[model samples]
Target chain A: MAARAARFNQQVLIDTTPLPDSIPKVKEIGATSAPLLSAAFFIGARCKPYNDDYMMCKTEANGRGELECMKEGRRVTRCAASVIADVNTHCLSEFRKHWMCLENWNQQLWQCRRFERDLNKCVFENLKLEKVIPGAPADEIPVHLRKRQIYAHSYANM
Target chain B: MPQDMPPVGGYEPIQYKRNLPARGFRPAYYLLAVAGIMTYGFYKYGKGVRELNELGREKMWSRIHLIPALQAEEDRDQVRRMLADKARERELLGAETKVYHSDRFVRPTFAVVPENTTD
Candidate 1:
């Protein structure tokens, strides 16, 4: 039986060992892709500084940044996870609606603009985290704020 | 041919011409209309592509910004495992032995999972 199981076992040794007691523990964010994408802008809005710091640490540490930047990394994780938690708490229905729409629409933002609007508004109002597409054209409205979506799967949402 | 005669105006001048007016727009007008439609379609297509590209950019940057933190998390677990394995090896063998031929530092990305069940 063990031989058969071993023959069939596909699990690679991506170890699950936790950080030791000397290192401060940070809980991993468990949200999957759709939910994460739905909350990504807000996470960026709230965690930009921490994220930049972590990236800087990684860049400065050369290849060894992976080990050297754990502290900055933990901060970034906590900030992002906190943003997700706050959005989950304050805008559960809107968040669900947007991500579910995202899941249904091949994760296309165009298809779920209405639900995203609701989520963006909710996150901004409740969590004070605004979704601004960085480096967007200044002369025109951002693509996300457009009233018409030419490529949407459904126009009713628009 | 039973003396068939012209009933009215010599059978309307034999009625050879297809007098039915051509339907729809004239060729030039229709071509212009089609060209207009295609141009508009291409314009809209361009806009959609541009929008999609911008969205892709946003998604990419988001992931890029996310890498450091996520990498750090994985590295922490890896370092912990390496330390734990080293401690265990020391306890079992009374001293640490090199597992690699080189003296240079090389981080192993994975380990062989120990099998506990006896076949």
Candidate 2:
């Protein structure tokens, strides 16, 4: 017998409505997965304050934060969007190369170290936004800087 | 035939050496070498696991930090759509109807209306 669903709702609704005039507007981020992963740390580095403020506002608003934290939310969105735009403008080639490598390599940073190094250098120099993993061990070299990635598919770096 | 047997010094005392080259350390030394290698390998493995753990932690924290900004973008989009749906509802039907029992951003079931059949 064929299965029929009655109680469970599996419907998805997509409403292409614009925000009302009462609310301010912000443009959503345009970059997809690979680029977003590659640029995440830099975005975190650049937007720490705004991000923290937004989170704090959300926490204070509790369940009501969705609508209440619009101001803080707008700041967070703008901060992230600005970081992405800046990177795209300043380090276009390096950014493209790194994200492309990431996309081809299952988004594994270890497999894309060479491109990542180049991208990091360019972003740091042009945007002054460093990619740092906060709370990483201070005594040892960061994973990104290691000469060999034990888990990489290719032995080229090793 | 002049008794060709027992020539000088009984046929040169019949040499018995096989000429095989001797090599390799004592068994105890070999054991020690294996132990040393294993110890170093285990140490390296532990170091690698720790590094991997730290990397994962760093990655998770990075994502957590980025969530606020990403969520803000998504929330804004949702808010825009909800507002748009509200406007559409008002245009199609002359008045807004209360559809929820409690207030917590319920995506209205009638938000996306299929083609109207009523003329």
Candidate 3:
């Protein structure tokens, strides 16, 4: 009876009734495990920069660098590129670099609220995960999942 | 007797009178001159008021925008000075200070001068 109750609790936890509103309609309709995993990954990446201390620290440092040296302002562009590359490579070192780039970007954004707004607008408008990531395709993924991924990429640099 | 009576009857008293010169359209001429002066005065005053108002508006606009820019510039200068002082202190202590670039948002062309250090 104890084993049966544990199994029931497990089943209850896995029940899909209380899904978030932000999750796309397509993800809900098809109800495939792959789409769910992808959505989770996208959300995780978007929220990563905000929560990670290392990324925040690096972002602050990068903001300082931009303030000090005008020439080094291009460092921001390079850092952003590096972050995208890291996402593609999926290497641990690349991941660390990606986080650092995000940290820098966030620092700059915080310093200038206008920059933050502009960056957010750009990400929201131009986010194409399938185009940025070679293997991914827009049609295969749910719309909310794509949005989450875009938000993640956008904030990743911040 | 007839001659005395005729002289008495014919004699009459003559009074002296002086004739003044006519002043033609004096009041009309004075009115026209005053009107012309008044019209010129109003035009000049209106023009002056308009120019003054424009200048005041321009000044107000400049003040509104200039204050913030001046404050930011002063803050930046102060920060630079403080950094310079810190660099001097490090030099006096013979410490190796790492120059960390601040990622503050400013124009892309501005360059900050680093403080002088011995080591």
Q: Which candidate has the highest lDDT of all?
A: 2
For each candidate in turn, the interface RMSD (Å) is 3.8, 4.8, 27.7
Stretches of candidate 2 off by over 4 Å are A1-12, B1-27, B88-119
Superior by TM-score: candidate 1 or candidate 3: 1
Residue A78's lDDT within candidate 2 is 88
Q: In CAPRI terms, where does candidate 3 land? A: incorrect
lDDT for each residue of candidate 2 in A1-158, tens digit (9 for 90 to 100): 25865563324344444677778777888778788888898989988999888888878877457778898899988888898899999999999998898898887777888888899999999988887877788998888888877777777522
lDDT per residue, candidate 3, B16-117, as tens digits? Answer: 666678677788898999999999999988855654443344334323322222222333344444445445556676784445476533443422333322
Going through the candidates in order, what is the number of backbone clashes in each?
A: 0, 0, 15
Off by over 4 Å in 1: A1-6, A10-16, B1-31, B99-103, B109-119
Ranking by TM-score: 2, 1, 3
Rate residue B66 of model 3 by lDDT. Answer: 27
Q: Is candidate 2 or candidate 3 better by TM-score?
A: 2
Model 2 RMSD in angstroms: 6.6
Candidate 3 residue runs with Cα over 4 Å from true position: A1-158, B1-18, B93-119
Best by DockQ: 2
**TM-score of model 2's chain A, to 2 decimals?**
0.89
